[model samples]
Target: MSTFPTSLTCTSLSFAWPDGTAVFDDLQVAFGPGRTGLVGVNGSGKSTLLKLIAGELTPADGTVRVAVEVGYLPQNVTLDTALRVDEALGVAATRAALHAIEAGDATEEHFDVVGDDWDVEERTLATLGELGLGHIDLDRTVGEVSGGESVLLRLAALLLRRPDALLLDEPTNNLDLYARRRLYAAVEAWSGIMVVVSHDRELLDLVDQIADLHDGRITTYGGNFTAYEEALAVAQEAAERMVRVAESDVRRQKRELIESQTKQARTDRKGRQLAASGSHGKALMDAMRRRAEETAGRNKHLHEGRLDDARRRLSEAEETVRVDEEIRIDLPSTAVPYGRIVLTVEDLEIAYGTGASRALTIGGPERIALTGRNGAGKTTLLRTIAGDLPPVAGRAEVHVPMRFLPQRLDVLDDTLTVAENVARFAPRATNNVIRARLARFLFKGARADQRADTLSGGERFRASLAALMLADPAPQLLLLDEPTNNLDMASVRQLTAALASYEGALIVVSHDMPFLESLGITRRLHLEGGELKEIDREAVGYPS
Candidate 1:
């Protein structure tokens, strides 16, 4: 900590990719001592900006200034499996030094290590418990927990360090509903300067304000996520009105220019007739002809200039009406009959550590939401249902055609183009058919030819969904696991709209309550304590 107030600011920041593509140019933004949510559509450079501020990614120009130390939790967290919990938390040395002193091997070196804060163990336990990690022992190995737990562990480490400023990117991606609640509580209790980049509605609602990064520009709005959206909706409405007015002006100007040009043509013909008839002296006729020619030229230039001005105004007005394109998934072939049995589970136990003994069945287009705590085997169950993993016992089956979109989105082949990836799922389909089908996912034209490795987070998700939706058999039963994890707000809306057109059975595993609520889920399943049962929406702490 320093005498100055905790702050993080950037001046004239500029950055570009190795491929000569620009992401930011001369961006100026300042963040003071308060919680701020950073939001924008995918590829808008929210994560890149955080990396620049945290010194992880250096800017090509300008500078990042911070009054005190900053702690950053990246979107993807990887820890050494060989390390112990204490070592991962950066407290191994201090804890070891304390143990030695307690064993009567007290030395000046030990004292230096312990410092004045001797209750490190108590603090560590409290922090872990706060993040729903109380069951984890200090000596536990990093490999012993689930992916979501590892994220919370890293967050706990940062919390105990108590840095002046904290930066979190997609912190709740892998967390379960319960774990997400814990993370939300931790965010609410944070008193220092913090900036979070996340699509989790609950977590974003805890922010003091929102900093929206759009088209390489930062726009600040007061209050939480809902407030920011309300404000944006109002602004977008006003911009649309301006666009209408400007368009009308452009049409009026074009009509006036055309009429004026026609009138001038008629007058020019009359002047030519008078000159040809020699009604006056040759000098007067020649002078009049020159005067008429100059006036016509002047009038033409004036009308053209007016039309150009009107067009320019229209263009400017259109630029102000910013909106993200939506993915269109109209799978008429995927529709299921009313009496069709889409999926069935009979006393099935996933190959993972957890076990479920309850029977389940999904008929017609019933949308099911699967939720549970971390390490509760949600992913395992989905994998088993998809036939990717063998069930420990009983049977898990899908009666109709199905496609699974895993949380990692690894189904895509990186070297192949978007159209090619979808083609892989439908090898018999022609390139023209694949590309035409891909347009529904918002990957039209050259975008459909882009390699999978080159796509942004949202684009990758959409491409994956496209591949699944356009498969040869046509997915009649779509199984999505954490589909909204890496998606931005706009992409989530696109996915929701796309799902509305699915016309088939769906079993989606996600912790995003708002996203689930919007899907018109017919039932909710909770898997925990070696049992799977139907739970009411209100029982899960959300409305229908």
Candidate 2:
């Protein structure tokens, strides 16, 4: 490892929206050399903060200082379609210059540029090869590759630069289980300071620290996600208890003040009686009565001040606890009676040529997880079940109301408002009902009126799920393709919690093993070379 000054500092940094609504204010933190896992729910400004660190977006207030060069791998990127893998790594002009210099016919300018560093190109190629793409054609255009491969290609290029720090955002989202494991190994071997924003618990366990973001604030922990969660749970419960005690104290103080007022009123009535009786007696009684009233008033004010102080402290505690607490909504699925043989696939074959092998077969609620390397037919088999794409030659039938959430959230209408998309997809529900359901999903008030395209990745995912779940006739079968790709940790937890209680059949095509295991997956279907094999949990990542 190189002796690099890797540090990031932010002081009094604030950011707000166009309407002057602050997302965060006076936030300060210093990130040193370590693997950090960033956690937050939807609309919590996790992604926005990452963007600030990457220098893609500037803070509205204060400043951020970084002393080292940073290499950022964005969650989604646009690549030039015509560029080949090798040329894209160094750009076309750089490759051309290098080639000329290698031919020994270069001017002083070219010689100076390529002097002694021409071999860096070989190192770049070696890095790509280490990422398990050694056999890939370097001259192949990026457009011809799968989206997963394209993502890996960009990461390979970024890693070859070998900057002082690395920022990866959801890098393992769309890969299969094998590829995800491979990525985990790659990250483990990385020697630079790294900050990763992801929902994968398994990945978070490898981090040196975990930073949780909520309500525009950040809290740092020294351990993994599991430790952070445990601490948060305990802290939330303690705060709740403290709040209850504070409320009780306020009520007690109010009662005492009321009793003291009643006593003072009785004393004044007696003094008035004495005043009506005589002259000298009236003067003495007036002095006593005034003293009593003054004393009571002072006591009342003191008690009121004490009550206010208690309330302020309690509110602060509540605010601290709110950051750790989650708002859970129970989505009640309609009771769809399980029919005999809801889905059946026999001798399913997905191959490019006529003489290809079989891929998959199913008969019931198997809770299948399609696993393989990057070019495998995991998505193709799921599409065949959804009837969007036909199998090469196989009998696949799904009888229930099957709902599919594709790799991209294409089910949502971009131009329509969130409420409008819900109404369009779930037409049987009335406007009021649809809005109420959306509100439960945290898309209430002005947010429901925002266009779907304007929402963040987490919000869009929640809206799509709301539409599907709120439909009058809920689907009995769910087919998800990389469903947790862009969701933050909290949102993923919310989903996993809801789906755990779901009585419907789920067929998930995801590399997230922890998520699948949490759902109590009964079997795993491994696909490779157009062949499907049913395996136990041990082969996937766990064992009975």
Candidate 3:
């Protein structure tokens, strides 16, 4: 903890995109003295809120107040590749002053620059080691390390500063299993205020509380991810119960209205018959008929009012119930025989970011997970296997049809509609067929007409996945690279559901352990230092 209690408060914060899309309006929220895991669906302005609090974006209205110094690690961290490790840590000036003093140069300027902290170098090295960057040297350039290492290097810099508050947005995104554990440990060790926006389940489990951002408001839930989930489940159950009760009330109202109207109609018929037969005096009969009509009108109006009130209540109750739609994927055509050879690599020397290479041979409906340091070239190997890139030395041949979903999701044509993009892949399929399939992917009717470029991150992912899976030649071998990188928990669940229906061989390059476990990965392959090796469950942080 710091000398002062850390706090962040936002007052009547309002913000909008340049295109005039309002994200938050009159939002008031605060965070104080603890770890908060911020979570929300895609397009709910979770990232925007972080940016506003970090002062990266100016709010259209209102103010953000921080009680102390802060350090922020963005979702997509970019370090100057040419910068030295010490320089990136913001300690080069102090280190230089210390070195000067060590050389017996008794200068007042050096003393002032060094201040009272002379263990800066050792502290920097220690921070780096804690984050699994022990092999990295102080004078090493950022370019010499992998992308995952860059994220850690940036985090290490922040940790060394010892700011009163730390904000991390998706900090564990590209990290491998080993790196993710290191990050989790760091998160556990944090003693001051920290706010994290991430979809990684393990990282979220370490937070002291869960802050749910929805509809431009923040709802704080006490405890970690599991506790938040339990609370949410209870809330959902209550909401669902309300909906059921409302539905029953509406049914009862309709039934009562119909029954009352039927009884009134029968009484009016009998009274009219009596009047027509002249069973009473004309004035008496007329008065009786008038009374009957008035009574019937009153009953009808009362019943109608009761029915309307019931309907209004039902509508209000329904509005309170949340609806989370799921996708339905059934791709029987993509299935391969149990004994079929999906792919073969004979001495395949694929580039692994370094001068060396890796090789592999996979068959049947195998579910493989590729894990390693970020720049160990998992994406390169996937692309090479997908035939997007040529091999460095040997051959990687796919015995069955294959489709690759890259990190960029570039398989889609932004200019075309979702239906049209799927049509492009399956030219023989009719519009109706494509649409029916797209509906399973949750692009129904007008949504299928939406252009690929206009899709949200989750929507784009689903669209891309649909096109690849629903191609003319159904893919028997599917390659997915970081499929859940930026997806929300809902979208991740959607992906899991879709994969459940896929009967083909799967090769996924992801650092997400929960997701990988959900996929029932048959073999875990760790790609590192130009070698491909199979690892056990414990090696991937999930032990059976």
Per-candidate TM-score against the hidden true structure: 0.90, 0.84, 0.86
Residue 178's lDDT within candidate 1 is 74
In candidate 3, where is summed lDDT lowest over 10 consecutive residues? 351-360
lDDT of residue 98 for candidate 3: 93
lDDT of 3 by residue, 197-308 (tens): 9988888999999999877889999999999999999998988898888889889888988998899889888988998888799999889888988988998898888889
Consecutive 10-residue window with the lowest summed lDDT within model 2: 352-361
Once fitted onto the true fold, the runs of candidate 3 whose alpha carbons sit more than 4 angstroms away are 1-6, 104-112, 328-332, 338-340, 352-359, 373-377, 387-390, 408-460, 463-467, 470-474, 535-544
Better of 1 and 3 by lDDT: 1
Question: Best to worst by lDDT, what's the order?
Answer: 1, 3, 2
lDDT of each structure?
A: 0.87, 0.74, 0.85
- Per-residue accuracy of model 2 over 1-544 as CA lDDT, tens digit each: 3355547777888987554546679888777787888888776777777788889878999888877888887777658989887766754445556878778866777766655666666776677677766666777887666567777777787787777778888887776555566678878888778888887888888888888876666889888888888888898899888888878877887787778778778877877776777865656776877787788779778878877887787777676557533325465563445444557777676544322335333434556676666667677777777888777776678877778888877789888989999898778788888888888788878778878876667777888888777765677788888878877766678788888777777788777767777777877876666666677666537311
TM-score of 1: 0.90
Each prediction's number of clashing residue pairs? 0, 0, 0
The deviation in Å at residue 123 for candidate 3 is 1.9
Best by lDDT: 1
Task: Predict model 1's lDDT versus the native.
Answer: 0.87
